[model samples]
Target: MSPGPGAGSAPASLTATDKVSTFSSFRVRNYRIHFFGNAISNIGTWMQRIAQDWLVHELTGSAAAVGITLALQFLPMLLFGLYGGVLADRVDKRKLLIGTQAALGLTGLTLAALTFTDVVNVYHVYVLAFLVGLVTVVDNPARQTFVSDMVGPRLLRNAVSLNSANFQSARLIGPAVAGVMIAAVGGAWAFLANGLSFIAPIIGLLMMRTSELNPAERVPRGRGQLRDGLRYVGGRPDLLWMIVLVGFIGTFGYNFAIWLVAFTDQVFASGPGTFGLLNSLMAGGSVVGALLAARRGSNRTRFTVGAAAVFSSLLVVASAAPNFVVFAVLMPLIGLAGMTFQVTANSTIQISSDPAMRGRVISLFMMVFVGGTPIGGPLVGWLSDEFGARVGLISGGLVCLAAAVGVALILARIGGLRLRISLRAGSRGLALVPRDPEEVTAPAGAAIRPVA
Candidate 1:
């Protein structure tokens, strides 16, 4: 369970006793700029998401059609994600991100123009979504690893947690704003706003001080690097199982876009405002979970597995809620658990992998995390179409719950750890403790570092 090749040395400044700042990464001017720029961009991105899904749903009046839109958008990632990761490892990350970001913005603008002209169709939406996905194949991996370049290893976990907080915090606004704009002006305005929001991130990337960044050693042009990355991950049990677990949860459990629309239209018979409210409530929970993770400052497999279990279980319960209020009550808790699981898994993999292989590793992670939307979205849409939205949601939750249990058992067996549940008054309760206390402390993946 040793760290895979290129697990760079711990930052020299980090120590056991250093007080961890919840916003430590903000101390760095570079990360601060990156944070604020992405914040604005993320809001726009969420707004576009709301508008796009609503547009597709409105045009076709079928949940399956919305699923198809999501499928097309993510199909490129399934097809070319590994190659994107390889490219990310070779190129200047900052420069590559700027290009991808600009391309994404243009796609938004093109969609806006077509909609404004009154000639937009579902096919146009599908094509534009696919184009955005193509850019994201490169953008996601580059953006993920760039945090390392911005703040170095010392504040990586905190920075990563804050990044989630940033996205979710924007989620708190994006859907509400998009809902209002869609009701007042049109989806076209939302698209236009999204396209313009790209300017902020592009400017932020330009404003960065290159000298202060901690760039990884860029891999030179070569063949077989993709295979090499796959092999590297294959040889590590920790990385493999963690990625598998996330793949299941992300693909099956995280199709909120599809499910929310289905529920709003079919079950609740509500409009975009309710949909926006639902998303905002969940986002509020996500923002809280991410900030809590930032404060917690340590990653452990048990915590991740537990969070996944809680998240998936909540999904199951939510599907059975008797009314909108009951369903809405669960959204924030689901968001909290889901975000906790995500931030923990993401930071763990990022920190544990060799720096040289980070892009590929992260790409593989993103590939499964988002790329599976193509496969799951359509199927879930069909289920919602055939049976009911509740059935579709509950099925996905069951799959995720099963996957979490399976992964936990696999990791426990591999690590020779057993589940321990304490009933003592002062006990924190459930944990995974090594069967042989004398055995060498669990592998690097299971090791803990105090956040600083």
Candidate 2:
């Protein structure tokens, strides 16, 4: 398929060399080590997530508790994300990551020990989850901005997409492995494995050739840095709308992790294996979506919006599925749409933001994207507990659809552009034609670079 208008003018090309070069970011030695380490570490992270949710469900048998756990895990992001972004701008991301990972590993090990000793309780899980969330406030933004420092601008998008691909691939393997591990030795083993997994990322960080790392743009620490970052995003309508769109989908639409457990337990009357299978199916689709985004290249606002629309629609369809088999068949589609929107939104934020303010801007992006979980997770969980799992899923999907439509309409009006939707493939279905061409061009010597 040809590139869409929102994607800028990049060609759709995915050759063997491109695939190889996509990993070129790893050739930096530092990034390569970080890549492998993070890959291993993230697998353990996913394992812990599955184990944690299942453990909570087993203890309380309530979907609302699962949601509350998720909220606790993300509430730190909502509360401290902006400050975390400010810290990312001011500190060495590598050093910060090492400490955070260590803390995370310890948290996993503590939970493992607690569970293994048979002293685990729901309150313990809640406290541990909250602590993990607190660490993530700093860990996530630093990690997001650290990618650019690893490869520089030349391969930022590729690195981001590849990172996402690794995440999804881990998603595919981690849950199934965790399911088997949990079934065999129990959830404690899974948690213990996650603690052990941190060894890899720590090794990667220690072994990395820091001298070869890309020079980070050091932002001057000032009193109004937070306000500055906010103003920066406020000036760009595209970035503002993109972040808003993502926030809506993230908050109301993307509660798959929470919903999946409910669906498997309450709806399908299934076990851990079935739950793992459903997640793996979604991961398969997400992998495809990430690859497609990588192939399409940078600056695709239209594709991002379109993907949001498709993601919402897929969720709606998936919610209505009558059987597990049908739901499984449709999961990949939902995964694809979800990942597509994520990759596109992430790329747009990274490519568009000013270098000095990138960390803070991306933090805001993360705040909206992840911070919404605290607000949404409990709501979805409550809905599932009060009504049914399907209602929770369907409500999320409907909200996503409405948000997408509303954002697109607002963008169209502000830009003075007409948007036309069509079912045709490889076509510019939505074109943004300014009433005056001169007004659309970047002002001379403007700091904002045109997205390529």
Candidate 3:
């Protein structure tokens, strides 16, 4: 059914043709187009990522070298993410996306040319990867804030969850496709496909009707906008804590993909086919986790904290798996927990932020979640090189566990909830001690609130 001449065109309204009832965010025609385009493009992106890492490993046979490649790819994100956020605020996101995507497509084509011509080396791959990462520094913030412009606050949670679902679904397919392509047509073909894939997003960006977008008050670029953004985030304890926890997880624990590549290649002596399978398995689980999150209404603090804890525990389990089959089976659990944690964190931050400052807050979130990859990749790579990939995986899991525990305790203290563990009927629950129990007012016949 066609939308009645701007009848179903509100930023927060469901369109006439949306299939998913629960995910009302897709009702927006522009976001639906954006989502589908991103889904296709992300598949190619993941294909390139897998092929790139494999190519680097094939050339140098060093985990540290792979880490260096990852660092080069992400270093721009660490340095310029805040500036990118400022840019997002100052410019039209739709236009910014077009420019970034075009640049990224050119970079992919360049790599494809090098690979197809048999002139590609590790150095060339590193340089191209760094260039692509630079584009992403701007692209990530623009894309994130763009979702709000598409759907507004009402369905933002659902939109974020659906975005994760799209990403994970691509994750499940892209590597497998890349693996087949690599074996048959070679890595160059995968790169070419990635370059071509950018066309979908470019088309989506062009197709969007600009007048329908929710326009935030554009803050003019001037003195201290960066500082103001920082201060705004710092003042909100919830947002601050959320970003910090995500950073800790991203830096120390959430980088299983890179570690998984090394573990499969070096430890298990598995080929790209096996590596692709592991990634697909994890992505399959992530798809499930993301859909479940989409169904759940709103993001809560406890959900964020609990998901992190569960994610860390699953990582420990995945790290201890004895063989490739066991590890593959554990991949889904790891992906489920990890995606849930991330979706919860992303949604909470988006919903809590003011519209005018949403770009900066979302950029900070991206910085912590993605920018930390440069530092963590190198550290994990060094660990894999020195102590073995298993040690790198295990150490990362432990760090995640420690961070989750520490953050939980800190939040509990700040929220004035005394943390106590009690086993009731073979299940554990947290007991709360309110700071002023007598002063705590409750509606008549209401039960006491339980601490998470």
Please state the error at residue 158 of candidate 2 in Å: 0.4
Error at 238, model 1, angstroms: 0.5
Q: Sorted on TM-score, highest at the top, how do the candidates line up?
A: 1, 3, 2
Scanning candidate 3 in windows of ten residues, the lowest lDDT window is 1-10
Tell me the alpha-carbon RMSD of every candidate: 4.4, 6.2, 5.2
Tens digits of per-residue lDDT for model 1, 199-279: 999999999877667778889888899999998898788888999999999899989999999999899999999999999
**Residue 134 miss distance in model 2 (angstroms):** 0.7
Candidate 2 per-residue lDDT, tens place, 211-238, comes to 5566456666779988988988887777
Best by lDDT: 1
Tens-digit lDDT string for candidate 3 (341-368)? 9998998888778876888898899888
TM-score of 1: 0.92
Those runs of model 3 whose alpha carbons end farther than 4 Å from true positions after fitting are 1-12, 15-21, 423-429, 437-452
Quote each prediction's TM-score.
0.92, 0.90, 0.92
User: What are the lDDT scores of the predictions, listed in order?
Assistant: 0.90, 0.83, 0.83
Best of the two (2, 3) by TM-score? 3
lDDT of 1 at 332: 97
Please name the candidate that would achieve the greatest TM-score relative to the true structure. 1
Q: Comparing 1 and 3 by TM-score, which wins?
A: 1
Q: Between candidates 1 and 2, which one is better according to lDDT? A: 1
lDDT of 1 at 162: 98
